[model samples]
Target chain A: MIVAERKPLDEIEAMLASAERVLVVGCGTCVAVCMAGGEKEVELLASELRMRAQASGQRRRIDQVTLTRQCDREYLDALAAYVEEYDVLLSTACGAGVQLLAERFDGKLILPALNTRFIGTAEGPGVWSQRCLACGQCLLHLTGGVCPVTRCPKNLLNGPCGGTNHGKCEVNPENDCAWTLIYRRLEKLGRLDLLDAIQPPKDYRPMTKPARLVHPAFQTESAPPTK
Target chain B: MKDSIACLGTETEGTGSGAFEPKVVAFCCTYCAYTAADLAGAMRLEYPPNVRVVQVLCSGKVEAEWLLRAFEEGADAVYVAGCALGDCHFLEGNRQALRTVAYAKRLLAEVGLEPERLEFFHIPASAGTLFAQRAREMTDRARRLGPSPLRSKQAVESRKLVLPPDPHPPLPPAQLGRRIRESEEL
Candidate 1:
């Protein structure tokens, strides 16, 4: 799931300095599960902002709302009726959700309250570790289930780099060497032969930025001629 | 009004001399601390009237939002009183409350309020005197700290009727009460 962390309070306060009426929008999906952008977080933030404004005599009007999912157009449509009431919309969603809000509300100032961290999974309660880089490639079958692209800082697809110290990565001793994990898994499964085949340089064209996909059923040949 | 904010005593009961009387909110778990409070009352143990007691099912149920809301609603100081350490009715409710209090304290500091204004107390049902002492301790701390910064804003807000007219105007009293309570809990 997409992970995110809230921006510092000082940074958020600075963003709201000029906006008298601010609406805090929370995304109740991935970010919510990560405890970054959720209903409770929105309330906490709104309360903090209110107290700070009261302390400084700012006279600001801060409101909060949480959408089911901010990345989808249907959810973004909910804000259309009242978006005009606020000078700024502070979104506590991942980058995609924030950008979608910006696109939907083109005239309004939409700012991100969270920094999109990574595509990761929760390792434990309140702990998240990056698991995928979305490099438009999958070599997990060849290298056990681990993605060397993300787990290995060097992204060495062929095998472990010379820096694999025992079972730990040379760059960070705390991190387990991805290749070592792969080798052990393969040996256990008697699939170590998968490592004998050398992999060529990866093709990077698929990872080109701003990628999009139209469903096979939704593909249109041409636009109908306007009458 | 929804979930009754149990008030042990009235807020305006002054201590004379135009002194600032801090309004302290104490969330007591029913298993231990609340029972202890009852014991304190039976013993006629005299403690300051400034502290208001809110009884909850367990200290673990005392959420971070509740602690924050107390201050937001003009509480000078707030504390969660639960079963002492391992003696929690739910086995680990008091420990959970300890972590919650610590987290709330950091949040208070972030909002420019003194973290010391919020605390957690471990008081078993047998410790009636200790419960009263905790109340006294919080009240004294609140007195030394003075009124919370949020109180002045609350005073100003109270002077004016800020609530908009109810949108759905025709609910029964119980349902309306529940609705308001639900919103408050949110």
Candidate 2:
């Protein structure tokens, strides 16, 4: 899941300074799961903003609503009727959800409340650790499931750097060396021989910006007549 | 009202009950602290009634959100009490809870809530007296801090802030930015 944290309260307040009526929208999917920009978070932030506004004597109106998923148009349609009810729309979703809101709504100031961090897995109930970078590459099968691109301080693809000490990274002694974890997993699986195959540096050509994918069925779908 | 904000204005600054009674939420593990609370009651060991005991399977199950929500719901303080160290019914439950407690303290501090408002206490099931004593200590600590500043903001005086939804749509970003800049110039 993509992890996110709400922007600082003061920054969010600055974004709202020009608006008298504000609507805080929450995304119920990834940001909600991560406890970042979800329903509970929207309430908390809205309350804080209200408190701050009251203290500053700022005549502001803050209303809050949460959508099932801000990234999807179908889910966002739930907001169509109420979208016009406020002067500013503040989204407590990840960057993608905020952009989707921007695209779906026009003539409104749609602001992002979360800073999207990275693809992570919940390590514990509330603990999340980065697990993937979405580098448009898949190398987990050979690397024992850990993504060195994200886990390693050096992003060491080949092997552990000389700075690796006693299975811990020298950069931060608290962090377990990613290569060390990979080596141990492969060794336990009896696939140590796979490590002998040297991999060339990752290909950069496919690391294209604004990447898009079209389903095979979509290609042959009937199209409207062209002029 | 959906925010469940408990107090408002002057009446809130002084809790309606006359005396300031701090509300505290205590998360107790089923095998240890929860049982200890029951034993304390059965033994007639009096503790402050303010501590509302929530029984959990393990203190380890107490997530950071639970603690934060307690504060948001107007809890003056919260504590997790579990089995004694090295004596968790589930191995290392109390130890794991301690780690979360530390993380929660920093999170509370960041949110302008008092970090001391959250704590972790460890005691064996047999130590009923210790449980009551800790409850008294937490209640006293919270009483001194007074009601949370957040409570007063919910008063009707904040009507202008939580105004009904406005019909006027916002100006475009370009125009809004110009408005702020012009206001600043004034």
Candidate 3:
């Protein structure tokens, strides 16, 4: 899922200084699960802005609303009515949701309230750690479900580097070496022999490209008659 | 004679007769505290009428700024009531609520307001009597403490600031660059 973190309050306050009517839009999907942009966050931010305005003796009118999924057009339609009521829209969604809101609103001033982080999962309650770089490839099968591309500082795909000491990464002693985790998993699965196989340099073409997806079901209807 | 009149005026002001009734804002979780308050009303339980309850989807929805704003806007007391631990409708909402409230207490103390003015309670929705009891207790405590010094009549009237919906929007690339530079220098 898309992971994100809330921008500082002072930073957000400066963004809406020019607008009188502002709308805070939150997404209830991936961003919500990560606790970045969600219904609760929207209300908290709205109240904060109101308080700041009162303290600063500034006249501002802020409103908040949340949608099921900001990236989906169907869910974004729920914001149509509320959208017209504000001069600016603050989206607490992931990067995709922020872009989607900008595209849907077109001429309106749209802003992101979160810093899009990475594709990750909750390590524990209130903690989300990066797990994937989404390099348009999966090498986890050979690495025991751990992605060195994200966990390793150098994104190494092979065995442990010299920087690894006592199963911990030298760069961050607190973090366990990804290679160590991979080795233990491989050893448990009786696939330690696979580690000896030398991996060639990965293709950079897939990582450098823009996002793309293909589905066979969707292709059939769009494909024209073949000669 | 003028001196005697001035002394009498000072005495009258010090007595604080006809002082404004303290305004208390309570953020109640809908699943528990709010329902409990509703039950209190239905049961015809008499508690202080000073509190104005704002029903939020969850106690976690209550922000620290809201509590500060309540005080800034002339609320002598602010209370947040949520479900007991492990009983939140949206699991961990109460826990987060507790943390936020604790933070607000420290912040309030730092700002010269009595930290005791802010309170947090965890009660089940079925505990209507407890809700009433807590409400009355808070009101009495606030009454004894009197109005917050920061909540003078002028301060109350001055709190009519109109906030823009998104008071702080994300800065454009240019402004962000300037901000980063400023921070680095600092």
The lDDT per prediction is 0.84, 0.79, 0.77
- How accurate locally is residue A3 in candidate 3, as Cα lDDT from 0 to 100? 88
Per-model TM values vs. the true structure = 0.87, 0.66, 0.66
What does candidate 2's lDDT look like per residue over B58-89, in tens digits?
Answer: 99988776776566556788899988889998
The best candidate by lDDT is 1
Residue range B1-186, candidate 3, lDDT tens digits = 123212221222322577556666678999999999999989998877777777888999887767776675567788999999999999999999999999778656644568899999997899889998888878887888887755543331222122234322333567778999999999
Model 3: per-residue Cα lDDT over A1-227, one tens digit each = 88898887767877877787788888888888987788867766675565555555566677777776788776666566667767899889988889999999897999889999998888887888889887877888888888888899888877889999999999999888999999998999998887888888887778775666778776656677789
Higher-TM-score candidate of 2 and 3: 3
What local lDDT does model 3 show for residue B185?
100
Superposing all C-alpha atoms, what RMSD in Å does each candidate have to the true structure? 7.9, 12.7, 14.4
Task: Locate the minimum summed-lDDT window of 10 residues in model 1 chain A.
Answer: A50-59
lDDT of 1 by residue, B69-105 (tens): 7787678899999997789889998988999999889
Q: Which pairs clash inside model 2?
A: none
- Colliding residue pairs in candidate 1: none
Q: What DockQ results do all the predictions give, each relative to the true complex?
A: 0.20, 0.07, 0.06
Runs in model 2 lying further than 4 Å from the true structure: A51-59, A220-227, B1-108, B111-113, B117-143, B151-186
Measured on C-alpha atoms, candidate 2 has an lDDT of 0.79
Q: What DockQ would candidate 3 receive versus the native complex?
A: 0.06
